[model samples]
Target: MRLSEFSVPDTLAARGALALAEQYQSEAITAHALRSWVWAEAFALVDGITGIDHELLYVAAVLHDIGTVTEFDNHTLSYEHAGGHVAIALAAGAGWESERRERALEVIVRHNWPRVDPAIDAEGYLLEIATGLDISGARPDALPREFVRDVLDAYPRGALAAEFGACVVDQAERKPDTAARRLVDGGVLEKLAANPLEAR
Candidate 1:
């Protein structure tokens, strides 16, 4: 399988987000974040999607699941909203301008949306496709089969299905109006478990 061609952003924002995710997120979550970035980048290339801000996508991808972390997780906010807020503060600390910081917030929050308008936010569209693919194995044809396997080999799923599912389940129970609740009501846990990626 000797797959070593993959790489990720090393810019200040990318590096800062990576560090933040490492420090606050669990092993499964950190892996999910990394995989999300890889998948997002792949989608950009394969789909010929352009006008992407690599740093922004990298930052959003790495921190998309931030709210699932204990430090950022809260009782009132949906994880996506909490994660968006966390990204805003973290991006500010990383010296991102107000507009860029707000964009990051939008990208993070919109990643959980049913669909993102690519014309409006390329980063959000990519993140949604990538995260949806990574966590639930939706739209399996978006990427080549071998490439998917290689990416999985490099970043194993470990307990992501269990850990992330539990987090959403918690969110559903506490914040019934959020997307997390809808996902739970829709049997997200079972979907995660049955995700074809698990067999990769």
Candidate 2:
């Protein structure tokens, strides 16, 4: 999973989804989403996890945060659920079959709640772990240091803590009892402040 060779899907659905994501999200959020794909792919290689559809994960990674953006934000459900629907719709419009589209939705939704079982859904599990690594700075030792450095070089995580904190605070206001609220109440800011990546 070399960052040098990493590329977003070139298909219409992928392009459209990315365009929407870039339109709605701040630069930091968009960069974070792109970095998620790089981190997930690198992690997969480290764990020797194979059979992944990189293209599908690319789609999932880019649109996973649509719920956090203004246009798609839903007050009732968590951002993950809201964004999952948007991802599914994007996949549907791209002519993805039901099973594949549903899998993309599952990956987006599962990313919010950590620890998706790899056996059940490897892509979802990888996305979950990848986002966790980016957001919470969890498990710094999970991947090789050189790979992490290379990724940061390619996609510098500029002010990710502040960006993610703001997003979570918004979610806390829109929907309580969700993961965002837990993260806010659980001192995620302090955690973000303590992120080792920020030290770089």
Q: Find the candidate with the highest TM-score and give its number.
A: 1
Off by over 4 Å in 1: 1-6
Model 2 bad stretches (over 4 Å): none
TM-score, structure 2 vs. true = 0.93
Give the clashing pairs for model 2.
none
List model 2 lDDT by residue over 1-200, tens digit each. Answer: 45776667789778977888888988788888888988888778877889998778988998888788888988788898888888889889989899998888889988977478888888998899898888878888887777778888877888778888888898997788888887788788887888787776
Residue 147 lDDT (model 1): 84
Model 1 lDDT per residue over 1-200, tens place: 12355567667777888889989988889999999988888888877898889888888999998997788888888888888888888788889899999998899999989899888889999999999888778888878888888888888999999999988888888889999988888878988999999877
Candidate 2 differs from the real structure by a C-alpha RMSD in angstroms, to one decimal, of 1.6
What do the candidate models score in CA lDDT, each in turn? 0.86, 0.84
How far residue 165's Cα lies from its native spot in candidate 1, in Å, is: 0.9
